[model samples]
Target chain A: MKETLLPSSIKNKEKRSAVHAKLKQQKKVEKKRNQKVREAAEKKALELGEDPPPKKTPRTIENTRELDETVCKPDDEELFAGNDADEFSSILKQECIPKILITTSRFHSSRGPDFIEDLRSIIPNAHYYKRGTYDLKKIVEYAKKKDFTSVIVVHTNRREPDALLIIGIPNGPTAHFKLSKLVLRKDIKNHGNPTSHQPELVLNNFTTRLGHRVGRLIQSLFPQDPHFNGRRVVTFHNQRDFVFFRHHRYIFETKESKTPEGKDKKENKAARPGKVVARLQECGPRFTLKLTSLQNGTFDTQGGEYEWVHKPEMDTSRRRFFL
Target chain B: MPRTTTVESPGCPPLRALTFDSLGLVKVIEAHDGQDGGAVKMVERWGDPDSSKCVLAASILDRESDPLVSVARKCGSIEVISAINGDLRAQIPNHGDEDDAITGLHLFSKQQSESSSRACKLFTCTTKGHARMESIELGGTVAEFVRDPSPTVWDVCGSGNILCSKIDGNENYALFGGKGVEVNLWDLQKCVKIWTAKCPPKNTLGIFTPTWFTSATFLSKDDHRKFVAGTNSHQVRLYDISAQRRPVISVDFRETPIKAVCEDIDGNTIYIGNGSGDLASIDMRTGKLLGCFIGKCSGGIKSIARHPQLPVIASCGLDSYLRIWDIQSRQLLSAVFLKQHLTSVVFDSHFRKEVPVPEVTNTVEEAEVIETPAKRKKGFKDEHTSKKKKSKRSSKKRLSDDED
Candidate 1:
């Protein structure tokens, strides 16, 4: 269109930087000639059988959220009898085993004991402690008198570790979170150490009801049988409410290239020639969490009972959310 | 009259309520006149999800002609049931051989008996301080094996714990409170105690503040000497008992532990909730606060009720849902969920009043067009009078709280 009136009436010193690099090379050749005429009209409308164009959807705030009538309806028998009577239902029915404890927030720093030693090697029977001058309600009454079925804490601030808490033990629902992008395990990249077995988890979306009680308080911090031959795992995922975490380990391999480049080349010749693929690896200590406040027992920051708190006017709406 | 014909269905105003949870289930919700998320209905569960039959204190006798409810549990019995078809009817053992626990149940009515029957009672209390009562009866114009099951117990506050009670409004005096216990009161026809409170001083860092009390009530409707309570540290307080035994107001709110307080039938507001799902509403004659109640209740509100002629309010807790709200636009007019943790709710108030009452007069004309013209200019400076006494004395001074 006359190069948008020829680069602002070519007013500059070096002739308007050569007409703004010739109008950005004529708008990258008119956007690759309009993407090769929309891929030759979608390959001549699939060789003329017609109907090949309806693809656009991308408006994501997790597919425009804001409807949430407490979601969780996969055959909700009163949300499975309220998760078979909560408080992590006796370590989720394995009839009790959790343990955890972990600690930190009391003027602690050095990357908060290296992120609670990478969350005590990704939470199994966890342990850690040393938050010296006590008082997280006295380490939740000394981890509920040592039977500690979860406590966590972490917290730090300038040297990083930014906040975590958890709690649960001896009648509690605690939670708290907010920690952020950490990385640890010697800053990742090909990382992979984990193992004393237990890992497995996964979790993902957690669909509402306060993301299923913060996904059963992060599934009562591990251990209810998950040694999957230690191929480790540990996910948490939960998209729009933040969570994320990660860690991995799988293996399988075999399929190196059967035409796997990009655009479906006829669905890559329907793969299968020596298939196997799996792979994964990155077992570092990445992080994210978000929650902010769940409380209900245990660590009483002066009276405890909050079953959900995170407010800034509950973020008004960018597709509102609350895990 | 074909059940007085009404069902005007457009959605929003047919509530019913009844809750009670922590596993010994009980549900009942309802919501009809069309919808807006309703239908809960479990109606009876009672323990054995592998022990700890929880249900720590319930209540709902809705001035019975049949309804009933009671609950109590944590091993100390009480039961009752019947709110229409959930049956059971009686039980009553309480403080079950003494390991203590029940923490307040309530019911109340006790008066009829000249063989025409009626009676009522229940009460309960516990977490060590005990308190009992019992009666029930109901049957009337004769025969259910000549009724009378007997219960009595009433040691009232022989020691601490107590958790919370209430009674008042002419049921003569009850109050209680808990944790390190403080607010006392008692005298439900001579069960004793009478007035106690006291604590509050120290803090210029001199520490002191601890006398727990997690939830108490009675602010008005026949006073019994004022009171309010809440605490476990999120404070609230109020008290009075004919002027100062301590808390003549106090305040705090919002670090959690208030767990349900209620008050407002124009008793100078109150509400509370806390333990985190924060419900708010304060005032109690200027100790102030007020706003909160919009949506957020993931759990911990344990029971709020309010609707003795609907301005709404329901609540429930530990996030098993139930909600309701609309105390003049404190909003959230309907929620439901009902999975478990609940712990007590109530409000049946002749629910669909003989089938509808024109969907409760079209929800009092959609709560008077969703209220808020600065609360209809602080109670009718003449919106042409009698909209039922200006919506019942401008929705009788509001306040409510939950999360226990």
Candidate 2:
């Protein structure tokens, strides 16, 4: 009746590969024919005043994520009330300007300072301090006395910048993040230089309660009033609980049309003239951050209470995300 | 594999608890297991509007009358509110400045209060060793709240901050411990020190272990001499005053310091939660770790309270979620996100007073999984004989080693 033996079952290797390739090509042609037939059917149905077939959505980790109860809902009175009294409320309300003090761990690495230098260029009113055998607790005390609103500590291991600690001033809710995939400004191609004006902050995919708190913490590192004229933007995009940091500058450009040698280009231009398009040129220093722990108070490892701790067991499901 | 229990099972009631947040917000949470998953919700909320006046410590005084919640503010003020309605029953203004914040608040009834059985005394202690006790009665038909009279104040002789203070079941002794402070047991009747925990000897590095006790609790409900204290160095020390001044058994937990410790109703087991959200149960008899509780908490556990009757415990923390866990299964039963960093939590034993028969029957049925009385008796007998034989063998081995 039909040849039941498959190409993979062929005894000769050369013959098996040849048959396999031929079968693949035949299958490709068949798929195209079936796609055409389906499209024609859909087109004919539309022309006959009938609805087209429904679109099939592709399955993805984000779309098929487990249901999370902590996802923030709009018009939640309790969440709003809690946010109003949070530690970053003053900075978020624009009542106080955020003055950040950035430093590295006790043992310094070459790349750590370079990363801090790039960070200083991005954050306004940020000053870098050299860590020289000074205890973090002592530095926190000093920063509090000096009226610094926040402290950022970069920790390096094996000559690579690995961890970041951000502590809110006076009172705290310290956050520790594992940093990776760092690309400096000089390494990125076609990267633009950042302007002195405060860049606008965009937090994306921060839907859960913990994500909202982390978003607010990152937001407090920058000034509340942004200069739109600068066209510079800093975005913290969270996907699968990894926060990707990106800086970009945007520009508006006019759309251009291409015409055939003998075609009438005027008709194409008359339909839509000067269609404007926005383009972004990235300013470098790209990185990814995964939160490790969130402490309730300042960076006191011995006694401070952590609000959340990342453990190996927490990664039970690939689709389960905290942020 | 965790079974989510439902309150729909005729006589089973939902777990009711009170939680306090960092901004002085108090919420009453109710939770039950549903077919789909655990369903937890906040039923009531009330607290000081001034966010600066953070809540430090809180306790629920549940007696024959309506339960009262005592919330101690960071500014040293204590507010007593009706647990049922969140109505302020009494407000005691700040006793001292902000630095002298209240560290402990305990409410207990005195034996001499038989004349006014509803009257309970509130014990409050501050970081500066100031202790005060005031009688408060919330049983009256008065429309307006009455102000409490002047309290009897004393000083606890301690060198450093008294971070925690807890009273024994009989209300005869109070245990005080804190940063740089050793565990001290004081007789509530005489107000004199009964026992003091000695400092542990030096370690291998010739360094003395710091005496910073973050949390302490009694090993048993009635035994004041057997105490368990957790230190800031991630060590849990069990002390039996009748045995020795030093700890009989000391075990190290995970890296982070232990923030909260609670004894199980069984008295042989203790649940200790550390700053890093690790909740583990240890058998106090042998100081061996039992399995850790399932369902990890995201934040440092601040308070753990065992239900007076149920085989469950409720724990809340800076993560702001109130979680109820079944003690026998060591599995999380239900969790409610409170939306604020919770500072403390307490179970409402008298949440619904309509039915008592079903609850009494439930305790026995649930305990069947662990063991029945007859089964336990046979097992105990076997264990006793085995233990005696093992002790004799160990002594003989010790003697041989000594001779060699």
Candidate 3:
């Protein structure tokens, strides 16, 4: 009768209950196995000094197709902010002197040759190139061979210098800017003459639109000297969106020796030279430039569409001096 | 292997546009045999907009007799065009939201029997964490669309995730990795999670942070259980399904991030291209750099595709040039200035060659030599040493042959 009952236990209801119990037991075993795996993973993560493993969410078809806007929106915002900050930070750390080449359009030369002379006085080290025809390829090749750091091409329309095309050397970013209200410093304002002391430069208030390229251009105009021996320091300050260029020179003077003991005392004091021993002179050629517009990629200024706008001011309180 | 000559075209078509905005357009140039010379002509160009919406991902559907090319746009549209001539066959607009960009597109055939009704499946994933699988019949019409239930937690922007692999020789699985450390594998047939592999955290400043994978591919057709990935931190990692949570093998390749990666036909070598326009072939077993293909790329390489049956590789990138190179010789065979930045390229496996027109009697011999049994055996024993000797011998033979 027990055997009959045991066989009858395989009846549909009884069989279903037995199968359910078996499944429950199987699930329990699986839970234990997963617990073991989780513990092991946690221990491994601890050993590596990492955060615990993320919770394993069961994969579902609905979850995979669900569009989560909140998660991606923050990431996009963060990426944009990060890129802008990185570009600014990288531009600030650059320090190199630029070798500039200045060229004028044929229209500018036809208008007057005095503009070239005036530009030469402002940037003494810039090499002047005569404009014959507008061949960008030939000019770029020539600039490369001359090892110029930057090329400043002035374009004139109807006898008025209208725009400036600045191209960096060896495939750097090119920028175009419209020039307005040109003024040449005719009178040599007698601030003072430079002596034999080293000088320092301060470029203040320049906006950060193409600030790095502009800063590089200004720095390259100066000589690459240690300034231990007296060197001229130029400062470019942009106020009211106009770049004001200033130059200063300092001369170091040695004290007269009274006796051998006095000379020894002077030598000991040489390491901490004060302002009493150095004299600063402001050399005049100060000028201001109003950058009307800026655009990326090379522009001919003669051909193609020209769209110029006044450059907006950037916060310059953080960047007081660019040396 | 048979040596096939690529005939040169007499006169190339003028590139109508040179603006950088044209980078958004995708063109496929077809070479047709001509009487005097073979003319390579643009068969189709998709996306004629001057706006900034670019192609994010594209896949060539080569399963059927007539292949189709599906391109995913940044504006959340998928366009299917005929491979023969650029004609819109089907278009799926608004696959994702306007702001949501599709990161990956893959085409694979279902494992169902021919009698059971075979159809091609198109799988797409977006940066918004959406994965959708659509079934398309042989005539380029959508039959059904199924979306996966479980989405990945990782951000898929810029990182190349959403890859399809054949699992257990029959079942198809899609693998996705993102900014998160975990890589999820999903069974496409059941639309359920199969397994997950957790990538090891990057050790930065004594802190463990997740490293995102930029590109990934299965090791080979035979070794479907294992896959390789290139990370944003310039690491090449290998993961095995049967292995533990961590990647089985990892190696640092370069300082710049890797943008594109592809495996050789035999699966023993991996070709990787980084952001600095550098392409290198790496040995899988020893994790050693075999050689770098020099002087071809001038910008970041966006994609690399290997020929289905030939020892040729086609690479296109931000440099706006499509270059074909010989894998063994590491020599640039041909280059075409496409005048626009190319994000991806795929060869038509069913491309038929026209009858060779007898124009010039002295035809340039195509250099497509297959390795013989004896040479292959010699190659197996100390490959590096044999390769050096072979190169030296080839140079000397070429010199003598030229003199003769």
Top DockQ hit? 2
Candidate structures ordered by DockQ, highest first: 2, 1, 3
> Residue B80: error of model 1 in Å?
44
By descending lDDT, how would the candidates be arranged?
2, 1, 3
Better of 2 and 3 by DockQ: 2
Cα error, residue B27 of model 3, in Å, equals 1.8
Q: Write the per-residue lDDT of candidate 1 for residues B334-359, one digit (tens) a residue.
A: 56665556778887665442233366
What is the lDDT for A242 in model 3?
A: 57
The sequence of per-residue lDDT tens digits that candidate 1 reaches over residues A31-63 is 999878888988999999999776668677777
**Deviation in Å, model 1, residue A114 alpha carbon:** 14
Off by over 4 Å in 2: A1-38, A45-54, A256-273, B1-13, B31-40, B47-50, B139-150, B352-404
Candidate 1: which docking quality band? incorrect
Q: How far does residue B260 in candidate 3 sit from its true spot (Å)?
A: 0.8
lDDT of 2 by residue, A1-323 (tens): 22566987789999899888888998999999988988998999899989988766867888878678889999887788778888899999999999999999988777888899899989999999988899999999999999999999999988789999999998868999999999988889999999998999999999988899889999999999999999999999999999999999999998867778535678778787767899999997999999999888788987788888898887777777899
When 1 and 3 are scored with TM-score, the better candidate is 3
- Candidate 2 lDDT over B1-404, as tens digits, reads 22234233121236678888877888888654442344557877886445666789998876423577888987677888767667676777886676888888987744355785446688888887787777766433223344457777778854788988888888888888988789888887787888888999999999997789999999989787898999999999999989998999999998988989999777878989888888888999999998787675778888899888788888888777788887777877777787777789888775542223367766664355123211111222344454654443433343343233
What CAPRI class is candidate 3?
A: incorrect
